[model samples]
Target chain A: MTGLVSLFRRLEGPQTLGRGPAFWALFALVLAGALAYPLFSDGYTVGNTVYFFVWVFIALSLSLIWGYGGSLSFGQTAFFGIAGYGYGILTINFGAAYGFTWIALLLAIGMAALVAALLGYFMFFGRIAGVFLGIVTLAVTLMLERFMAQTAGPEWRIGAARLNGFNGMSAMPPLTIPWFGGPIPLFADVGLYYVVLAMLVLVYLGLRILMNSSFGNVIVAIRENPERAEMLGYDIRKYQLITFVIGAALAGLSGVLYTVWGQYITPSSMGMTAASLPLIWVAVGGRSDLTATVIGTLVVLSGFQALTIYGSQYALVFMGVLLVLTVLIAPNGLVLGVIKGITKLVTRRKQEAA
Target chain B: MALLQLRDVNKHFGGLHVTNSVNLVLEQGEIHCLIGPNGAGKSTLFRLILGEHHPGSGQIYFAGEDITTLKSFARIRRGLSVKFQVPGVFKGLSVRQNLEIALQSRLHGAALDKEIDRLLAFLNLEAEQAQLAGNLSHGQKQWLEIGMAIALKPRLLLLDEPTAGMSPEETHMTGEMVRRLNAAGMTVLAIEHDMAFVRQVAQRVTVLHLGQVFAQGSIDEIVADERVAAIYLGQAHA
Candidate 1:
């Protein structure tokens, strides 16, 4: 019981925003609204909203990697693409009977995490940091994209699945629960939406708990100053590697979900453009704060979708301009800055009343 | 056993020898100071001891164990801690959070909170615990870092220029804090420039010139040494 109380207390750590009774009340209200969203909306719009949520995992991963861990990585999309393709190959080859797709999902995520551990071990343990770390991650992302884009030959077959090259591998099975009355497919509809929603909530809260833990405090210390953290008896490389693997696994979760949603996996998901897009999503939303990243990701994704539909040529241009403006004006993040302003105002008013 | 022993340690950067065959030892329960002129490699020697930089040739032993190849964090885990020349505080974190990071490895729950409280009171930073370390005054930041090092409860504490940016009053207070820490069975090796602060705290002193140990004696004997006065004290005042 005391453990539970301490966990609740940790939810209000200084590294994140929105806490106390009011914040929880507001969070509950928002969650309730989301739970009730499909009741009022059409099926198509609800499915599209699931797409927006799918990308939030990637954004949150970047937030953890860059914002708190202080290591900029463009390799998240690589992990996403790896998991997506891994899911496709496994399901296409073995077939999704008896809910093997669930096991496959775990395996796919595991594959991405393994690759991340290998890559992160070299990068962090080798002591590559700052912009050089960025450069290395970008190189790895692009290298994977290029390698996957060329597997167009018949030799690219893995059991029953083909690497279809730039067209991507398609027609994979959706995630299924082994229900008593046969398997239930989560086809990006309201069912999948709820599952993804539950995941997001759990992940967000889990991150809050983790960020407030002793491990979390040490990482922030490393982010502030690696040498000082080392002198304080921390193996900074180990912490950084663990953080990177966690971020990669989350990205893998997104990849698996996205692939399951469309029943397709593509190399373009790990392309240079796709890799940089998450950076913008994370940076413009305030890279340091998870809440800001979530809000910013949803808002910007909606805006980008609208631009892509109406003014296709201007979509990338709009994103680039928005990124520039974010760096110039509210570098900490526009959403986070607004939240801080309101918090300060409320605190001052309460103080004055006292 | 001596708390720390460095034998024939040499470090070079290209052709320039930074630490030249430096041999030193610190007995347990002593407050020792390292004084040197510019480019005398005093800081470099500290780095070698901390294992931030390995010696080109030689051995470092701590508590009768050879730790020459041990990484900085490993050495630190064996009861070694340091307050760097710069105030290496987690500037973005609160002052209390800074100490929490230090004590979190071996402490938890109420014990963690209790230790944090003790450190805050020790540093006289109870009032500023909630303030961001970056926002603290220069002296406060230094004190907070000292508190962080002390939070580790190290057997050997290395303090590099602990009073670099402090006023005379603050420097005197720092000397008192160091003496207090030493009195509590903590051995300290401090690299300091202030003669007054050294006189106030140091029981023994070592003078380095051009990366070589020039003199080692009582503070008064070192102060009275014409050669140390000619090389270090004279150059410091210049």
Candidate 2:
């Protein structure tokens, strides 16, 4: 894993640029591993892995928004929930047929983007940044949780869908896409896992390409220092708003996928623990590098689930200790922290040889 | 019409009047230096010009257009760009990437490479082109920032304290660069504390005190004014 991570880092640097025979080799190996997952794991295992991939998508969005875009959001789950509910309402009557599922997926992403744009317009244009942004976003998330939880009556139903209070909208049909066959359901456990994994990889690659573009350069510049970027004639607010929408779209996509996987959407998904999950994931991974963020999310999240499965009384304690250690020793996140140490060791060894 | 003008601009932060009916102008192709002590509102006036703060009451005209209500980026699009007190280069990026971003603002395609090279050469930062901007020394960072401001293809360049923490040699070089830019037909409006730098580059100087223009004249004329000595030079003699 460490060797592959180092290879990934090399690929990120401009010189490698994600090409070269070694990169292709690593890519093939990872592809083989992902494809052969069903051989080694059961349907339940694949399902949970898909579940984990859903969070990974959200984690990547957070990394982009906070890490590169410089907008720390504690409420990204708000957008995720927005999409979940939006998808549920849009596709509820059709039961994943008539291709409404695809339309609903797009609409869910669009709704999240539009909402994010509005939120960003208000927050950034008002010059509400830094910790203030986090506070505002968290407030939005908590507000959604409370708002959705209160819809206990039949009046809360949109079309055939119901905002079923804490029980959530259960038995929502699985999302199906236009395959070689007409509108095939992605409900099969292994198939759903692959779909989620493919989306994750695609989103990852898309964001990577974007960060290398001039647009990405400009936004990151705005992130580093808004005033400086402003003086240079870049509209800081515009960049922030645009990136906010993109991140929201990604989150919305993740939420849609999660709803499909879980077969239900809930108000508690945006509650305290769930809302803060990505924060721990990205922070533990390190926000500086995208690869680190993904790895960190997988490692910590899997460990967390393992602890829960064993019914360890110290599960929460263990999570806290891991986070605290990352904050102290790694600070950059465990992946990058470990990478940095490795690079230093290599350089020292080279020096000794010299 | 002046290249840049502020007429009857009034800005007050509650009781503290940061700008009081202040009127200033930078003529085309001239190096105009605004100089004052710490509380003289020099920076505030610069902000007002850069659209960082809108004047409470007044008009700002740039290149014969009313730009009083314009945003900072809009004002910049109108050919006004600024370099702040701190160096404004994108530190995480390479020096070339920093210049490339600025170059991209006005130029694109194959032209960008040539422009980036020209800017790097102009600022004598060609050697540091591949280095991270944050790793550059103070003088080089300032030069890189200046390079960025000019890369905007600004008709009027606003620089705040360009030589604040420079070595004397670097200060001289910066003064020379300012003169070179002015000669190249860029209207320069600079707020500076280095009197020697102002003497080297300024065609005309404006002195402000207590949020208002105290005097405006040729550098020598301002130096000859007794009030300027008592107020700006901190002399007891009047």
Candidate 3:
């Protein structure tokens, strides 16, 4: 196992930290904590845990784009909201006979991926980059918010699903699996919590595998220097488009999961502020490191949630301060520093033993 | 036939004729050094061959095929690689990862461990395998970039100023490395400003003056040429 880890370290290298048995132990502990949460908590508290998992997915999506793929986007919510609407409308129109839950999820994921690919094709090939890329992505989010908000009339109905506009869709079909033992609703608080936790583990594992693959190496190389990568025979625009589409697909999936938990959809959730939430999470966590980004999202998000309970007005201020400190003190993310410190301690012990 | 041939290639940036009806050839298995003043179009000729900028007129042939219309990467895929004027190593990646990226550029998805092991050993960078490339010294980074350039395993390597900022020892080491690679049958085309370093590695010299080849001969012959000494002596000192 150590040999494999070292080989991967040599192949993928120092971009990742503490990616050995110690890291796996921490992962296992987190898994255990998530699995044990619902057993000790009420339905409402379990619901909050599920929400945290959803946000983790959103933050991971942003990290993949910005940290790994090296594209900063401010409109991930556009894809998220697209997936939400796709789920709501399709589930409503299809009804329970077919129980098209899986179909609805696919639709949502596809919708966002397609839109992102189109936007990426234009932006990357047109050579629109840096801050301009951020602006274009933000425009997409704002346009979605305004367009969805205006769909508040009788004429805005899609099949059985009514476009409630600013008032919002109060209910959607529950997440269900057509079990051989009959249908099982996955959205029952404890069940939904487990599903989200399992999905989080799967996504984390999948991303880890990808981050060490040749594809991941190429993407990181492109992020560092597009011209150099291009000169080395890589099609830079193709890879950029691929990264954008993957991020959008993940955000869309996160939106589907959010819709399942909240049992509703709202235009406000697709606004600029909502979109920026993932960016802040990624920034505070350490944008380039996956583990750091996840840790940052969880700790900072829970901190903000705790603040809101104490004094809602001060939560934003606290978040702002946290972001400022993260930027100034640990620009790589506080979690990265923690990982480095752990690595140092382990190496010191090994040297002493020798 | 030459390994690379440029026939009357001309390029212009609006009104500035950077490459004025330039004709050149690089024969196989030879060490060729290109030297000229800053605006003498030495680098522009490299770009024209790499397909970064297409000639306004004329043709580029590589290994005897017309490649004037090929894109930069397409040309690379045909077994050509370049070491840029600037250090082009990926700073965020480790030395090992950087080498892996380069090797993967030419050879894909197999036992690259053997090749990577060989490269690390050849460059004597095994101790810094896990070190982040950004932390490498300027000379180390230069060698690492050379490691990356050779990692492509190109039949022809275009090196743009391999000893620009190196000390005498480092420059001598670089010259040795270039000679070793050429000895092993890899054709090298180098652009150099350091005359001492050039004389160390030069087999033949091509001097460009104002977008055209002013003279081409063995190093001793060119150094003894009155016209060559007069045009370059002032700029070379400066």
Tell me the interface RMSD of every candidate, in Å: 0.4, 1.2, 0.9
| Candidate whose DockQ is highest | 1
Each model's fnat?
0.89, 0.78, 0.76
Query: Each candidate: what lDDT?
Result: 0.93, 0.84, 0.85
Candidate 3 Cα misplacement greater than 4 A, ranges: A1-15, A180-182, A310-313, B105-110, B233-238
True contact recovery of candidate 2: 0.78
Candidate 2 chain B lowest-lDDT run of ten? B229-238
Q: Per-prediction TM-score, please?
A: 0.98, 0.92, 0.93
Top model number, TM-score: 1
Candidate 1: tens digits of C-alpha lDDT, residues A155-199: 999999999888899999999888988889988789888989999
Instruction: Score candidate 2 by TM-score against the native.
Output: 0.92
Model 1 chain A poorest ten-residue lDDT run: A8-17
Pairs clashing in candidate 2? Answer: none
Q: What are the RMSD figures for all models against the true structure?
A: 1.7, 4.2, 3.0
Residue pairs of candidate 1 with colliding backbone atoms: none
How would you class the docking of model 2? medium
Q: How far is candidate 3 from the true structure (C-alpha RMSD, Å)?
A: 3.0
What is the DockQ score of candidate 3, to 2 decimals?
A: 0.75
lDDT tens readout by residue for model 3, A171-261: 7877887787888877648888887888888877667667777778888998888777877877888888988888898899888888888
